[model samples]
Target: MKFADYYEIMQTIARYGHALDAGTAPFDQIFTDNVELDLTHAGPPGQPGPVIKGRQHVLEAMTGSADDPHTYRSVLTRPALSHHTTNSEIVADRGDEVEVRSKFLRLGNSQPGPMPILIGQYLDTLIRTIDGWRISRREVISHGP
Candidate 1:
């Protein structure tokens, strides 16, 4: 792929953050039907843990968890410490698909609490379907409590 297209792909990957800024649902739309998030890699969030599958499942994870006062407020708006910060791995082509990995980090803090740092990677598999480049798989690995 040319440099321009490569940049475009990276931008699309980063766009997930932009949409999260404007969206109430954090990551549902960012993932595809076949996508699955293995949050166990970072342990669970207790009841209604955020590990989810498919776009709808991920959507519910974001929306449903927002019922808790703490979680709701934490996510209703973007965390103060986190913005759109990401570093992408070299994009590799796999026939009609592209394999991409990116390191993501964000910071968040709450009243009467210590400011926490969040870091993660988006392991993505994008495919060039009839609709053009679309995320076919996504795995989120986070380093945070």
Candidate 2:
């Protein structure tokens, strides 16, 4: 793939981080309409999380609505900083389709401590659309503290 394409993909990942930190609902822009989000590996030990289908479902999970009681609004509103570092490697680049394996480190400083709250890796599948490159599938693998 061209460097521009690579940079664009990287930017998309960066945007994902920004949205999460800001608690903004940018799912529709970042992911495809029928995106598949697999967070099973990120679940607690002995329990597997369900694979979420559709952009709307993923958006709700990421940014809960005002009417949702179990949303992560409290956490997102904290006076903390979140950083998402991605080391992405392009596995395949077939013109309109791209697959990337990215090692991600998500750090959150919500308290007066020098530690992170979450860390994970993402296996992403992206497709080039009329708007731009959007993620179609993302498999999250968690590495806990």
Best by TM-score: 2
Clashes of each: 0, 0
Q: CA RMSD for every model?
A: 5.4, 3.5
Give the Cα lDDT of each candidate: 0.59, 0.76
Model 2, residue 121: C-alpha shift (Å): 0.8
lDDT of 2 at 22: 69
Query: Which residue window of length 10 is worst by lDDT in model 2?
Result: 66-75
- Give every collision pair in model 1: none
lDDT tens digits by residue: candidate 1, 1-145? 7675576567668766566554543342345556676565544355233556676655456445533212233243454645454778757786667888888765567786635466767788876655445566766676664
Off by over 4 Å in 1: 24-29, 44-51, 65-83, 110-116
- TM per candidate comes to 0.68, 0.84
Residue pairs with clashing backbones, model 2: none
